[model samples]
Target: MKNKYLTLLFGLLLAASSCNDWLNVDSKTILTDEDISQYPELLETQFLSSYDDLRGCIQAIGDGAFSYRQHHLSSFTDDAANNTPWDAGVMSINISPGRVFASIFSQSKGEILTPVWPYKEINKVNKFILQNKDSENSEVQSLVGEAYFIRAYMYFEMVKRYGGVPLYSGSLDHINSINDRATEEASWDYICNCLDSAIVLLPETQKVATEDRDRANRYTALALKSRAMLYAGTIAKYGKVINNGLQGVRADAARDYLIKAADAASQIIQENKYSLSSEFGDLFNGKDEDNNEIIFRFSNVAKTGRQVFHDYWNMPYRVKKAGYTAFMSPVLDIVEQFEKLDGTIQPLDYSAKFSDPADFFAGRDKRLDATIIYPGGEFMGERYSIYRETRVKTASGTKVYAYSNQEDWTNADKVPGHESYMMSGYDGIFPNTSGGGFTNYGFYLKKTLYAVKQLEDYLSAENEQDAVIIRYGEVILNYAEAAIELATSYGETKYLAEAQTAFDQLRDIHGGLPSKTMTIDVVRHERRIDLLYEGFRYWDLKRWRIGTEMHNKQFDALHPILNIDETQSPTAIYYTIERVSAPDYLITRTKWFQERDYYCPVPTDQSPGITQNDGWN
Candidate 1:
């Protein structure tokens, strides 16, 4: 039976890439164990074929090839807004028949971002682990461990969305049965157990230059376990459960999961492998200047690397450098979360604080500058001046009255009489176009964007930035969060202080901000901003049961409008950050989530008899 299924697994893997580039190079040979052993390199090829399926880091930004491709997960949250109908169904939580499965299909037609059956990868990984568990080869054991890690990672992806998925640990000639849903408890247990097995089998790290460092090691499994357990704990404690036992974790086990989360994090923390750093911004910029900070990065290096079309989608609408549209825009709700330089949580009092709109940037978190591109902000050493050079004809030989109210509109171009700009900003009216300059909200993104010298043509052409899956900053924060939860449950102050120290490390480095008064909420807020676009917000909100409160409510697009019509402002030209109407493309409709909305609707086309999540039925 094992031999028959091994042959099927090999054939399925080869055939899975039938439509892809994998078949173009490899020989179409029916492999027996004998044939594979004779050509040892074929085994390596088989192993590598596993990663090719990932293509790159998971991006639901609609590019595809990432798992489950729920672009709406990020878009629907308050943190981001997409200016296209592609994700409207996602944002509104209103899944119509036409767009019911549109989330996965939104990618290029027939482009499979996630595997048709994740079981295919699971089967391949299972066979590899079975073959390797007894092998004395340390190198081969590491490969085996990675296989375990890969399986765990893949299963967690499904478990996160589908709640619980069918379990498959061994070879199969065919999956003839329904392979019914395991309880959410069983699913998380399976995932964590897989990681534990992986940790025991793998080394601390593999330092050889020839080997890919991106492969899973001891810390990789633990980091994922920590994160996964944290999710389970949050969901069990804060979310709702159903009669089917498919959607929610048991509340009784919630604290235990949280404790396990802290323990998993503590293992990594005690190892002293990595930590937060001053050059934290460099980690996101693709330079990898501070390598120690990243625990396990999704490599997008040379031939093996995955290229993300970031600038193609996220480039500022105003910039004519790239032809791609500004796909996703940041929301005012998230922008306001960045704390003041003094570490105080003061909402940007648009009327009072921004008498001059550009003063909005003053004394803000340094991370705000690192992450967002605001008006009057400079990039690549050049200030973004949207003002054009064209002149208006006048009686005095084109006495060029600056068409912009930017200089004279509010007397913003100076500190009253100084040459420097007091409100170094625009008149708030840039021509809105489909191609680039129109912003749904007033802000632009900078964290995902890495500026290169004019010497390189690749910045606009291709993308290969390292997708940091786990970093030390997150580890510290995770530990901080878990510790805070533990403290809350047990009435301990040490854990609170510990979380405070962890947060203050980041706050101090980014801006010499004050120490945090550690609570789970404060720890989570730090995570929201610190791990901004790395795709954590949606689940975080969902798990906290706040999605219905924060996300289901009507949100505003803050327009920093030039209101010369009003005497309400002392300065006739002072900007008003009005809570203006959301753009038509922005899905501003309030979300309506029933108790069942707590879980994602399973894509029914994948299989028959697969139970629908809570409310979907």
Candidate 2:
């Protein structure tokens, strides 16, 4: 039996590698139904391998150099902006309607920006389910349940991206013969049903010795169901069903889906297995490994070296020695979303001059301090001197010495007084033409960056911080959102009390802010603030039917100017905030998100009967 299992696994893996088309299965290499019936244990090896395939979607990392080394999903959203000019394709396709359709389907650019269809992973999962659905071994049955969860997750990834996609059930032999797209309603239903199966068979908590903790449990399936159902609910309420329900759900079904989302979340909450982490910052910096806040995450055990490259790519230039540093610059638009400690939201007045630019961010939400590196902020035992220009009180009436690049700062003779002042901060808002290693937007991303004391530890792909895929914080927010939508949209007021408790707990525990009355806008603000840069903003905007509205203009950036006057004390030099274009470049293009951009075009080169999504053809 063991030798047979090994042979089947090798043949399946070999066949998977040789086949380019995910749908087409080579009959000679794969396991036959008769072979599976004799050796039911063979499904276990295949089941375990599915987790490896699922990691790509969970980590949000791709095989391409651009995705693995540079681009992040937050950069494609208004939450952050990409500073690297070479990787502008990430932003350009997202912003422009004219280029988006073709760019996503292009073989060269598409793989870098968008996630590839997970039909290959789904195929493996289907085969596992078909053979092991009635296995006599209890463990094999549990593995079959996990297969359902994996299939649901892959379909959710597809449904969210391309609306309705081809849903494959049974083995590869069955899949290869059929080519038809499921309705959007049917796709969402299929995902929810798969989760239902998983919830029934999966254990509440994974056994530490036998099963890996990172693998799916009952609550993990429930958590995903909560998220997926909420997405379907919003699409039904806000989107129009088109092409015979291939793209959207019926409006009347919105309430039922919202209820399912809320119930799934409530079940997890009632179980009381997880809680918010004590320190919000520790969640991402590899400090809170055993914390209850994480429901599901891609674990990065240190010696294995299977870790994320967040610190190497996203850390400010002053901190890291190698790689393209400060790749994502948190724009002012997202920075202002963090409310004050007193629960009053205030926008920064760009027109007003300040004695200190950092003062503009004073007394804001604590999450802001944890999530972004503002000008004059201290990080890794070093202060960020992110100024665009130095204003000196010269004999020639207040000389403004602007630096075009980092090299310009070293020359003292260039300044009027030769005062030996550092022109640009190691962290910067340099001109777009100046080159990489500086932020075009004033702020730097601090969410996923790990603080390394040794400079050598900042090597590419060395940071071992675990990438969080799903956490308790997101589930709490999902519950609050679904309940609030139900109450506000469908007049379902019974869920208000439970929703309010979940909503207030997040803000009070994680954010250290007093809770306000629940509203749709209020829930959304809390969600964005808590989950910033964890890669939820773009999808949230899409599901809410507000992508076109939120991303149709150029984002703003701050330019800090130092007041280096003789009258000012050397230690007490103040800075002023100057509103600048985010890129601050000539021939700047306004980011425009069209309604058609809500669904990415399905590539025409795929299966025969698959109809193209609306506006793509």
Candidate 3:
């Protein structure tokens, strides 16, 4: 998968002469400027080239890179959980390593710019559209809309990663050598307006072509707008309290944007085409392409398909894949956040006595069971055996059945192997038993593992699962969160009930249990569990801007850290005990040093003249 994308990036870099050179070498009648003018298909091909970047959209922004580390850094600034160097490892004190996140710091030059190929490709298509405006293909309008959406999306990613990024809406020429940086406000306005403009021209519905599934539609474009506006509104309004580094948007403007976002999302929901997946598990199981929850997805099919690199990042070490398993191991703090099955926050107060898995779910949210895998349960139609193996002795020595990895297990190096000496606290054991002691986090992911076979062939891009980007559930939560925050801020208690109503709709999808009072805290906690690994928690903390205190004090205080040796596979050695509470490290208040963490430092290398966002350097 990485190789394919590198090839695409290579093509984007050599796009000018590669095609012409290949055709010339073949002695074929190469389509020149005049030839392409006669054959309109040439223009269409040029326009279609933009889709390559879109097809790699998962790589472009969907990876856990942003959602987990970059965004979660905000949480570190906020008081959500502890921010260890191990989290992003290299960027511990905000001094990022050169090779790792070259673009993150100004040190590495242009290495960290948001994947530039897509923008360049989109620019090419937009230029093509403008140039061939006279061509009466009739299909060109939709293409223009798609181009708009793609460009808007590209810019949106750039804005999120780096607050005040250089905005390039049109084709860049050789003469346009100066690197321009737009104000954070201007960038947000441009992004939102661009998406709206794209939405204006797009079709309300299209013939569900396989190709078109990836292309921007009216709802998809609108969804992008909703997401952008929601972030913009929140940052602009909350930046003062959350992160002073942010240039907050006007509250009224933010509110207006939120309403627009809600309306756009409501249009998708009211239109009745998409809905919640009947089974929660089916959503990630890879068979539910028809699952209404997936409003917009980067569609991947067999062989040449999208490899969910994000999933690989946090996968459990017991389920091994790749040559290593460093990425995707769930942070210890995140593991404790899941509610019991009955809908109560997994108590972090360690003094509590309950240790049984089933008892853990008592009075907790049902969504917890839906999102995370508990100790012993049926996941993906297979019974998971989580009990620790015990050796029974009779006379001489005891015979024990311990979990052993097959010699060919790919993630062996990520473990405590004799050859590689790093202590990877994978599964249940901490690597480097004598030195580093224990790993900061304890849990691995079980959410998206299709099967053991799938784990073995992990690197194969054949995993065609459609990850849900925007779902009705999220929309409901978004509406509820915004309404609650706005209502609270505006001193109007009326919207609180509306927020509760939104919460009820989400609960109704699972099973209309009962009504619960809603608060920003309640909604935020619910979002953490509901959206567990769908990749939102870090960003949520960032926008709220309290990650540091959250990271430093919260989970460590709550969850008990047991010292386990790197003697064997975690799946085989330790008993999958019931959930337990941690100590008292959690900070109830949202107050913390959030401003510095709100926006990521623009990779110092991209624009050397621009100062690093305050407090980061």
Candidate 4:
């Protein structure tokens, strides 16, 4: 196996180095550079390999602060609570003030906290672009366009995390000659320019194969531009420039960037190439891959062994065969963000008692059902029973009892009189129980979890749900946001009508709720709900300059308590909701997001003469 791999690597190196040189060899493993170059189709084999690194940007599981790793971005924000007690880095370690202050942002060494890994991936993309940009073959030109999109996407990811990262236009020849960090404005400009080039060279769609739908097209580049420019525009409008523009954009440039974002999104909408999926849940349940809403997705086909473990880590406890489940528990703070069917925003009435706990979530936006699993919610054909405790009516008053484990319900010493009665639900939120398969926040994330029963084994990683990178729903929201920002922030009302139309389409068509007046706040709320668990919440808060307000506070969760009526014939049950801090132990301290956190601290020691973002030093 070692010799076979070595020969394959040697053949690839020779083919890439010298396309004309031929070596006469009889071994089937030895294919000379001249032999492989004869087939233009074989070039695709090399071009497709670049996506391995690009896919890392959206990988569901890994170790990193940048992408959706074990600590998903949603956990770091107010959107969700992470239940992994063994790994408290997301709450206790990663968000610490000392950790951020002492962070080493070298482009080469240190932990995976910084966006250093993307640069290594970018080098491969740059080399591909330099070699294939001028190819006469149209197929190869489209591949080159994809290369540009990959580079732009990586830079956008970097700039959002650490403003004004070092931009490499081509492959680096030496490790010592790294360029100085570009200004934040210049970095965004470079990203937009790359997308523009991609738009010009890419075809509207790949007609060769059905699987090519996952590949980048003209609309895919535009979708990214629309999203990226909105981030730049928000930073310019809300954040302040510092360190001679290395950290923030100019305030005056906000309107232009927003207009560019609106224009790019408008083109995608007007082209009529995509539409919202009829069923919102079908988009992520692996039931509808042909859905037109997905502009670009990371395809995870089970037959090919390129799959994800979303179901293994996120399915409800009753359905899971192993321990790793409910890794991301949706906090009540975000669950209430989903509006009612009538479009009214009402906070859940925790003070009110109810006959059924699921009634607390009644008449809410349909997307809530698709996105989260609450008490009495059905997932994978199993109804969830998420009560935390039981309250029994006694001669004196109501007696309260809590079960520590699943077996305590049947143990006489644990509950005594409740031995005949089920003390807690099978999926109960028990206290003092740490780790996965337990719901710390009394809810489980249903979005992105594959719904197939055959893939329910938590020990297996063979779940086949493609990660949607860029979808039309996000584009609609982006268009609405940029247009509304233009009208409200700059007094430019010409785009207001179109913005309202786009906003209403998303709400009425996908959310199944009425649309409200278009305001920056309304658009933001809709974006949060529509794009929840898609890994956009953290950056959205930072770019909107609301991280300090949203963080540095304890997020709340719902505790469902079942009230038993023994006097009734069949013993009726009622529920009461109590609000408490989510994962009180793991989230020991309030999550803090300082102003300096808007842009990560870059290391000046490794790169000489490079200016650090203000407040880091």
Kindly list the per-residue Cα lDDT of model 3 for residues 1-617, writing each as its tens digit.
54554454445445443222111111212234564445444444545556555544332223323222322222232213222223233333332221212232122225333422223444455565455444455466676777788778767766665576666654444312224566676788888888887787778765456544456778888777767877777776666521233334555666766666666665665676666654665565565655667666654446234444434433344444332332332344554555544455455434443324333334555554555444333455543223222233334554443223323122544323223221221233322111121122333345554542444554456556554556667776776776676676756454456557657767656533455677878778767666666656556665665554443233321122222234334422222232333222222212233445555555443234654555667
Instruction: Give per-residue CA lDDT, model 1, range 380-419, as digits (tens).
Output: 5655432212222223443222223322433444332223
Model 1: runs farther than 4 Å from truth? 1-42, 55-63, 67-73, 84-115, 209-213, 301-305, 318-320, 352-357, 385-435, 454-462, 490-498, 561-577, 588-594
Q: Residue 296 CA error for candidate 4 (Å)? A: 0.6
- Tell me the number of clashing residue pairs for each predicted model: 5, 0, 47, 1
Off by over 4 Å in 2: 1-43, 58-69, 87-92, 98-116, 174-178, 209-213, 301-307, 349-357, 394-396, 409-420, 452-461, 568-572, 584-589
TM-score of every candidate: 0.80, 0.89, 0.71, 0.89
Estimate every model's Cα lDDT from 0 to 1. Answer: 0.60, 0.73, 0.49, 0.73
**Candidate that beats the other on lDDT, 1 or 3, i.e. the better one:** 1
Q: Better model by lDDT, 3 or 4?
A: 4
Q: Per-residue CA lDDT of candidate 2, range 324-361, in tens?
A: 66767788888888888899888876565566567778
Regarding lDDT, does 1 or 4 come out ahead?
4
Total clashes for model 4 = 1
